[model samples]
Target: MINNFIKTCAQSKLSSIYEELLDTSKQALAVNNGNIAKWESAIDELKKHNKGGVNYQPPYININTSNSDTKLIQQSLKKLTPWRKGPYQIGDLQLDSEWRGDMKWDRLKNHIQPLKEKTVLDVGSGNGYFTYLMALSGAQIALGIEPFLLFNYQFMSIHTLINNPPNAFVLPLKLEQMPKEAVFDTVFSMGVLYHQKDHLLHLQQLKTLLVDDGELVLETLIIDKKHGKQIIPKDRYARMRNVWCLPSTDTIHTWLKKVGFKNIKLLDITKTTPQEQRATHWIGNNTQSIKDFLDPNNDKLTVEGLPAPLRAIFTCQK
Candidate 1:
């Protein structure tokens, strides 16, 4: 799979970074072996079944197959459960993920520049759900970078099920691992910034990787200024560790300005709902989701007494 991705990159606008990308991904996959056995086992199970054609079915990325036998496919997918990003459909099987990714996509799709024929980057692309969407949106090549080894395998699992997958490839690499080349016309950093210890650095890296005036779709956890300027979670915020900061929409704008991004615009600031991120049968062992993390008595507050999960989407040009 990686070989095919590398070969494709060689023939596209990403050729300049192809060598470095290959090296970085190889190194990342080499050191990240904790989930290899189980992930590969799941992939092996997936290969036993026949696949189908891929399509965008709004809330779910659907696959249309002539083969109706899905029992084995269902069992194989369940092995790689706790799906974080997608709500995909393979044949008749519904792979409902923990988060309704379509909601986020819907909020920003109309506001952004047209993706047709552009080279794109999707950072923190869990399972390449949006990556496939970008490819279908007509991006020349949509490259998704995710650090998690399991998600990389999950992407491969889905890719394998597609008879002729689009020009979308997800690699086990982080934003920092990518070579600093201004190749992408559109760069998306959705659900990624708050996880960075230095939010400014994250923004800076996004800027460095884009072509001049390239569009950046930045989405991350945010707090209403009524709470404060930002909330640096003490331990776990909404049952997630390594969440460094949640800035206000205004503060996020300032962060963008600090990083020298131009034409900044705050598109939306919507509160996450149970309907959007609820516990599902597919979320493996830890089925708890946003509802479980919120205070049982107060919907406005999290169990840790912090403001409930709210996110903001900001678009800017580098």
Candidate 2:
């Protein structure tokens, strides 16, 4: 039955089955006291399910900004010009004013308050949701670097209509393609690092974009002690290949140090919610499917070549 389900998920392009495999693997670990065969079998099934073509590559821009080639930068800047206003909606998530008064809505805002009046670079500012939040928190200027053309357009239009223009400019280029101008005071990257093929190289690229003594906020999945290896599946989602590499916290700290970041700190750590958990076979907020595969006690698992919780968050400074 399990194998058939896995095969069905593979043939039907279903992600929920992968989530169930993850749950079952975790349960097997708890029962067998670390016997790994069940976990391995589950991962194999997941690979079979994800055997499809990958998502499209994000739009790319050239990064040459020398004095001799100022045209490119000029053209990029022109592309950044804001458009007419559109209907705006207050985001679903709300901030609690009293608990952490005047703090930026990120992992490290409490310890790093007075984030106000600082210029911020929101890397991978999907739809500018967080970008809008940062601007509201008194960030003097927020620059969002998003490579998707449709998202860039929506972010621009939304901000223009909100009566609270993004103090923010949306760049239609990836982080590596942006000019090395020390215009930003801080950098923010969330839910993005794991997507890069060369995570370390991308970290180095982010470092080059920051001014000396600037802070960077990052969040992604990390391998726990229990999970031994990563399992690469064949599935692709929206230009992002579903590759899960869970590095330990210590390993990530080492990477940050290697990239010359200072004052590294683990601000907040939260387990993945079972309903919206990334490792599960479900995508988005498919509550019915989540309830079906829900295993309340089996929180930790070694499946799909990655640890469960399937995601994590972190903050650091450069």
Candidate 3:
């Protein structure tokens, strides 16, 4: 799989750092994780099945296959639990994930520039759901960078089941680890900004990865203007740790401008609903999801009494 990624990158605008990307991914994937054996076992089990073609089937990152052993495939995939980003369908089996990613995709797809034959980067791509969509939308190469090894394995699981797969690939590498080369025609940073300790630096790093006049699609948690510019949560918001800041749309625009981005546009602002993020059987042991995180008295507020999750998407040029 790494070789395939290398081969593609070497022939694209990313040729300069293809080897470094491969080496970094190798090192990241080499880290000792107790669950690696189980995940690898699941992937090995999946190898016995036949491959298929992938396409968008509304809610699913659908794979076309009819003769698959649905029951066996389900069992193998269960090993990589807590599926957060997708609601993929392989054959007749529906791997319903925590997030109905298509909903997010629908909101931003038409607003952003067409991806056909473009080099795309999906930062913080969980399990490569949107990355696959980007490739299916006709990108020359859609590279997904996810630091979590399990998600990379999940991506590989899906990739393994696809006959030709698309130009989509996921690696266990962080955004900071990527070579600061302006190689990508489009870069997407979704659900990643709030996790950064320095949001400005994160935005700057994103800009540095794009080609001149390239587009950036930024999506992350945001609060209403009533929250007053931003809210730096002192503790967990909606049962999630590592969430540092929730800024207003205006504040985000300011940040983008400060970082030298041009033609910044706030595309959408939708409060997250249970329909978009809810637990499914595929999420495994932790059955609790968005519903569990909200306050019993008020759905508008989290259990901690903080404003609930509201996300905004912004597009700009580097």
Best-matching candidate per lDDT = 3
Model 2 over residues 215-256: C-alpha lDDT tens digits? 788877666645444434355321235554557677778888
Off by over 4 Å in 2: 1-106, 164-166, 228-240, 274-306
Task: Estimate the TM-score of every prediction.
Answer: 0.97, 0.57, 0.99
Angstrom error at residue 61, model 1: 0.3
Per-residue CA lDDT of candidate 1, range 44-136, in tens? 877767878898998999988755668778777777877888999998888889999999999999999999999999999999999999998
For residues 1-318, could you state the per-residue lDDT of candidate 3 as single tens digits?
A: 767787888889989988898889889978889999999999999999988888999899998887459999999999898799899999999999999999999999999999999999999998999999999999999999999898999998988889888999998899999999999999999999999999999999999999999999999999999979999999999999999999999999999999999999999999899899998998888899989999999988999899989999999999
What is the TM-score ranking, best to worst?
A: 3, 1, 2
Give residue 102's error in model 1 in angstroms: 0.5
What's the CA error at residue 293 for candidate 3, in Å? Answer: 1.1
Any runs in candidate 1 off by more than 4 Å, and if so which? 32-34
Q: What is the clash count of model 3?
A: 0
By the lDDT metric, which is better: model 2 or model 3? 3
Candidate 2 clashing pairs, residues 3+ apart or interchain:
15-281, 16-281, 19-280, 19-281, 50-234, 223-246, 230-305, 231-305
